[model samples]
Target chain A: MAYLELNNVHKTYIEGEEEILSNINLSIEEGEFVAIVGFTGSGKTTLVNLINGLLEPTRGEVLFKGEPVKGTSHERGVIFQNYSLLPWLTVEQNVLMAVKEAFPKKSKKELTEMVAEYVEMVSLSHAINKRPKELSGGMRQRVAVARALAMKPEMIIMDEPLGALDALTRGNLQDEILNIWGKDKRTALLITNDVDEGIYMADRIIPLRPGPRATLGPEFKIDIERPRDKTEMNDNENYKQTRNAIIEYLMDIGNERKSEAQEELVLPDLAPKDFVNQFK
Target chain B: MKQSVSLNTAGKIARFNIFRFLFQGSIAKVKQMDPKVALKKVAISIASILLFLGLWHMGAKALYNKEADFKINKALEERGQAAADSEAACIASGNPDCQPNTLPSPAQVWASFNSLLKDHGIISADKAAFKEKTAALNAQREAENLDPIVYTGRPSFVDQIWRSLGTVFAGFLLAFFIAVPLGIFIGLSPNLKSAFNWFIQVFKPVSPVVWYLLVFMIVKTVLIGSPDDSSFTISFVSVGLCSMWATLVNTAMGVSSVDNDYINVAKVLKLGTFQKIFKVILPSSLPLIFTGLKITLSVGWMVLIAIELLAQSPGLGTFVWEEFQNGANDSNAKIIVAMFVIGIIGFLLDRIMLAIQNSVSFVKTDAI
Candidate 1:
């Protein structure tokens, strides 16, 4: 069985209404880094929530280790896109909250140390005592990253965690997350809009077509070696080919959507009254 | 050693500078002030207060003269020119009997305030002396399981102030305890909120007098057989019922309007319902809760005097009522003093609540 599997899942917010996600099927093996890249409002978050057991599919099932996914568990840690850190808590406390729940048996000292380690991994040690409001957007996201990682979940699910960050901060965070995942090769899924980010950090990059009923597209395997360098990626032949194919496919679907949306309206033929036509 | 000596001298200079700043109004300190904004603010505040007092004095003088003229004209109409002249002489002589008892001037109000303080001191001394005189007799009565001899004198102005504060605090606590938990429960579910909505709407606008009357009826019946007085209980209960609506409404709104993102975070963490409330909901809703509490305190204070007077309780409300009824030479001035005290105390209560709200809240909540 795959480490995580979605078997022909469909999701709709209301009954008898158009679905948000339809007939979605995907599988990720243990120790795999998978990225699902999509346009904004493509139901990528819905897919991530389904996997994390925050939402149930309208049809079919999501399986984790051959068991059906249920309500949220610490084993599947989610890094939400908006950095859902509690405003009242400091950076260290936010991470500690998750760490304590995930490892209830650990001593207070042990938990503190673990939180410190994760925060240090994200290079936010200097801001450990600061509340979320005091931190910048990028720093808050880093704290969210630390909070998720500190829990030591079996799988990490990120929903555009770096989307709000600037390009430089996004690059740094991508490298940090990749380095952390490299340590244990845990099952990780990243949902992002940035193609370069997906290419750099993920082993297999899949595209989610834009929705009313969004579904996953074919996967592209990155043949690039581990510890890929960004400076040399532009010069690489394989990188160029994969990038072009993905961009072209995305553009084709976008144009297709536009064309589909532009159905001609049948106008009723009518004559203007003599009084109305006088001014014209 | 030289560095340590210099540090000591530096500390001494700082201490002296603080003293000068507080007491002497040192010009050097004023010159050293970088922004000058604070100094300017202080100057403005002093000028405004002086202006207010000046206006008050002028208004009081005008009213006094008007009443004096009316009194003299009446005397002339009743008797003759000699009677009017005697009335004028009486007014000029500052005779307490013939003086106009209209609004008191600022100086008269100040005099009344000092006299109230002196009255408080005399009452304290009298009570102490009575206790000393009855000590032996009280000890004997206590052995026999009887109530001790007690002083039955009227409460001083200071005592009335203390009593009013005590009642307000008691009422505030009652309001908090009853409103917050009920608010939280109602806030948790829309169904409960709807269930309780009609009841809240109906009772929220009821006046303190009606609440007091209702409480009086119930308390009078409840304590019929008991020997203890029920005035405090009735007044405080009425005050609580009168003031609790704002807190209840605010708390419900705060709890219900917590950010969806925080709720989502709580759910993702899989926190238990209890943990979710204390850890997430309560902390997030604290700002609103404090706003409600601040309003409740001020409302409670505003109604407390009226409630106390109605209940015949020994508080500031009753004190003011008695002085008004007494109609003594200094009665108007005493009433004016009470007015100033009430306004100042109300202001202080608000400031205290604001300080507490700011300290606990993540956001700096300004007074509404």
Candidate 2:
């Protein structure tokens, strides 16, 4: 059985109203790294939020380890977009807070060492004492990455964690995350709009359609060899094919949205007065 | 220490120099200040203050008679046209009748402050002597197992200032404790927030004097059978009630507007309700809460004098009122001294709050 399963999950924010997501199904096996690629406005965040148990699916089950996911748990560490960090706390302190909460039985010295290790892993040891406001956007995101990894969760969820960084910083962080995940082989779900990021980092790529009744599209399994290098991937024929396929799929969804936009705002012909007259 | 900061504007560079000067002694601060710019700002600030004092001295000296106003009025009254008319004419001519009555000159106020210090020293010495005389009687009472009597002598100027400080702090602390938990509760639940909104709005605009009266009445009634109903209790409670709204409103606003990402992070961590609030909600909301607390403390200090006066409490307010009523030669100058003291203390109190706010806030909050 898969480690996490989404059984035909559907979510509508309002009662008896617009459905944001419908028939979203997925099966993530243990130690698998899966990335969901989609166009903008694909409700990509909402899908992972459901899987992380930050939001509940309206009509389907999000099962974690064979049980329906209820709410957020330390078992799934989430590295959110926009770097949700406590601005008052330093980078080391930010990771230490999560570490302390996750492993209450660990001594203070052990937790401190663990926090230092993760901060070092993200190459942010120089900025370990700086608060979030003092750090750059890319540096703050690195601290967020360190904070999540230090928790030692069974699964890790990344919601476009690299979305806010510059190109150079983004590439460096991608390699760092890949190296860490390669060692542990933890169950991971990454949500991104970047096709290359999905192909390089994730084992399997799933595409989601644009929302207001969005659903998952076909999955692309990357049969490329492990421990991939960014420069090396460009030379590999399989990586090229996989990246092209994902981008092609996203473009198709983008065209679908353009047509859907035209059809979206057609108000019903029946007005309130007409409905009242019919009632009378 | 050798970090370079290039600036586009001279004004911004000057401001940065000032900031660097303020933080010069801190160990890890890397700001390199231009000494010329720092000196220029300091010189300008001191020059303006000196200019203000010069203007004040000139205005008061010109407006007030150096001497002999009483003699001029008396001579006019002796002519018996009308005493009131003579008094008015004498005042217009800058006679010495208005010496003690006119707006006090800066020098006179400064002299009065010094005199008040002398008076405090004398009063303290007298009180000590009185305590010494009563020591034997008090000891006898203690030996007999009766409660020893405390010295109920008149407090001096320094004592009054000290007492006022104590009372204001007590009031601010009361407001803080009462408002913070209530604010958190209201902030967490929308229904409670709406329910509290009415009470907060209604009571917030009520005058400090009215609050003082309400507190005095309630405290008096409650402590009718006990020794706890001092005017001190009444004044502090009134001050607390008057200033508590700022904290309550700010705390609720802070809690409700906590960032969405932090809330999501808390949920993803599977934090329990208590942990979520303390870990995510409180730290995120601290900036606003501290903003509220600073305002509340200042407001409490502002209203404390009025409360003390109305309650007839022994603080700076009472001292000012007593000196005003004394109608002595230096009474007006003494009142002016008290005014400056109050203003200086209020500024210091605000600076203290600003320091605390900066430390607690995630960002280095500018002293607004």
Name the best candidate (by TM-score).
1
| TM-score, model 2 to reference | 0.86
- For each candidate, what's the DockQ? 0.69, 0.58
Kindly list the per-residue Cα lDDT of model 2 for residues B233-269, writing each as its tens digit: 9999999989999999999999998989888877766
Candidate 1 local lDDT, B58-150, one digit each (tens): 999999999999999999999989999999999999989999989999999999999999999999999999999999999999999999989
* Candidate 2 residue lDDT tens string, A175-254: 88889998889989999988888888899999988888999999999988888778888989898888888888888778
After superposition, which runs of candidate 2 have C-alpha atoms over 4 Å from their true positions? A123-127, A259-280, B1-32, B61-100, B147-150, B227-229
Candidate 1 structure quality by residue, lDDT tens digits, A82-157: 9999999999889988887788899999999999899999999999999999999989998998888888889999
